[model samples]
Target: MAGLTKDTPYPTEIKLHQKSRILDITFSDGKTFQFPCEFLRVYSPSAEVSGHGPGQEVLQTGKKMVSIVKIEPVGNYAIQLNFTDGHNTGLYSWDLLYNFGLNQDKMWQRYLQRMDEAGASREPASRASTAQHSCK
Candidate 1:
């Protein structure tokens, strides 16, 4: 993991803005990131989202309006984000969070591009289909 370095810093402040549907995170190194709920939801590190192996990433669709209902601290290394959509598997560690923050723009662009190519919308997925479905 290139994101992990000798001076890897943990989160100093984590704030969720309900009105804006954003999660703000500040690291001990003075770096800060503002992540949209949808971004976090779709980019979840869980197997449900990331899949069990490479080239098997389940492209997350329809999560624009998702919101974080709760934030559970996972020991002292990571935080478990509980989404209003009932997704709480992703454990966002300090290094992972920092990496996501650093690559936010590129990652989001890639996500949007992939969505467009697959004709996926940002709207929340319907209840009829919530299981493992891949677009790539």
Candidate 2:
């Protein structure tokens, strides 16, 4: 697979819009993307977020209040996201972010379907009983 290069930096700028719940990412090459907070939340690369396998995927709800706490670089390939809700384990690679940028529509549609099936909304975790099985 082809990896990203300095000449192809993933994004030149990333802005977190608190009120809009959207992350605005501008690629160095002039590509721009706007990802919703819920979208970024559900598609988080953490195993705590993505689960282990296809069928084991988890639906993240109640993230309307969530915010990006930090963005830590991971070498030349990826970055780790620290969310305000204290759930930070995802390492979003350049390729993954790029793909997510490209496939936002389809992935979000699927996420919505899963949320509907689970009768879940992107709300904050309130009850301990709401805890589901881990992907491990």
Per-candidate local distance difference test: 0.87, 0.74
C-alpha positional error of residue 88 in candidate 1 after TM-score superposition, expressed in Å: 0.5
Residues 1-136 of candidate 1 have per-residue lDDT tens digits of 6555668989999999998999999999999999999899999999999999887888887787789999999887899999988999999988999999999999999998988888777766663255434332
User: What's the true lDDT of residue 10 in model 1?
Assistant: 90
Q: Give a tens-digit lDDT track for model 2, residues 1-136.
A: 3566565557778788877778888776677889876677778988877788777766687765678877788886777877887877888777677778878889878887777688766556673246543211
Per-model TM against the reference: 0.88, 0.78
Worst 10 residues of 2 by lDDT: 127-136
- Candidate 2 residue 24 C-alpha distance from true site, Å: 1.3
Name the runs in model 2 displaced over 4 angstroms. Answer: 1-9, 125-136
Measured on C-alpha atoms, candidate 2 has an lDDT of 0.74
